[model samples]
Target: MSDYDQSPNYQRGLNLVKEMLGDRFLAGLTASAESGAFAADCASIAIESAFGAVWSRPGLARRDRSLVTLGILIASGKSAELRNHVRAGLNNGLGVEELQEVMIQAFPYCGFPCVAEAIEATIAVLRERGLIDDSTQSAKERGLL
Candidate 1:
């Protein structure tokens, strides 16, 4: 284990990531980071800073943070990151409708293509988790539309 792996912040970040994304995520991230020095450094920083310093802050709930992160990722057209965050959002207590609404709310500002990609990524995550099926009419349910 490295110094960071023993640090309180790193431990907290690792726990937080595991709580939200599960152990498999960290495994894949660790495997990828093992490829080179730069990637390892970057992963350490992200785990310590992004997950520990920012995510552990008391100002916002994890669900709220997930929403903001998803919005930014969507606006930036970061589909891959969006997919990961969609899972995080669900784990953070966001429902499937809320996830869809986030994309819908971003549609006007982020444009069709960006929002479309985000929705597709979100749906993939939802499907992976078995949260939605082909016949689910989520938009119109509970007057969400």
Candidate 2:
């Protein structure tokens, strides 16, 4: 059912993300991707070679890990990636404020244009995942939101 299933590498990478993160977040990534956008080989490399191979390396804990990836992705203006990391960040214990802080930190070096875009994309991701909501209490109440 996932486009990623067509590529061994994609499947491998997806599994690796799962192993490092969890199934709920991986499902979210798979469900969010579009049709005909990524070929099997590319997906395989992205999933297996890129994430599976490099992301799980030593030197970072899983919680701090997504934050680093998220920082780089946002700083680099990778809108497409915002969805994946935004969801992973929250699932991995990142609060909305933390997300904003990361974006803001990227601004001094990455510039307003990228920060603005990342804010839009990351906020949309937060909204879609129910990480942002009207029912959400004040920042003090949740201690983060």
Candidate 3:
């Protein structure tokens, strides 16, 4: 293990991430980071800054932070991050409707195309979680059919 892997900041951030996203997701992230030194370094920075520093702060609830992160990711066209945040949002107690509303509200500011992609990413995550089905009926339920 590297210094960061043993640091209190990294450990705290990892714990926070696990609490927010669950052990399964954190395990995958750790596996990915372990593939390279640079990946490990980047992960350490993300853990310290995004999780330890920002997410661990008070004032905003995890659900609210998840929503805000979703908005930023959607507006920036960060599809991958948006997908991750979609799962995180749900984990943080945001219902599917709330996430849909976030995308709808972001449309004007982020543009239709950006919001569309974000919606697609969200749907994919929902489907993966078994919250939605891969059927025309399910698509219609979400107004996508």
Q: lDDT for every model?
A: 0.83, 0.70, 0.82
Q: Over the stretch 1-145, how does candidate 2's per-residue lDDT look in tens digits? A: 4555666666667767786557875665555453435553454456656776566566777668888888888788887777777877777778888888898789898987777777777767776777677464433344432
Give the per-residue lDDT of model 3 (tens digit) for 18-113: 988889888877776666755777877787678877898898999999989999999999988898888888989999889889988999898877
Q: Model 1: how large is the Cα RMSD against the reference? A: 5.0
Using all chains and alpha carbons, the TM-scores for the candidates as numbered come to 0.86, 0.68, 0.85
- How do all the candidates rank in terms of lDDT, highest first? 1, 3, 2
The number of residue pairs in model 3 that clash at the backbone is: 0
Per-residue alpha-carbon lDDT of model 1 for 1-145, expressed as tens digits?
Answer: 4566667887788889898898999877665545566578778777878897899999999999999999999999999999889988899999988997898899989988788778777877887899888565433342432
Model 2: ten consecutive residues of lowest lDDT? 136-145
Which portions of model 2 show Cα errors greater than 4 Å?
1-12, 19-38, 134-145
Quick one: ranking by TM-score, best first? 1, 3, 2
TM-score of 2: 0.68
Preferred candidate (lDDT higher): 2 or 3: 3
Off by over 4 Å in 1: 33-38, 135-145
Clash number by candidate, in order: 0, 3, 0
Clashing pairs in 2: 9-44, 10-44, 13-47
Please give me the total number of clashing residue pairs in predicted model 2: 3
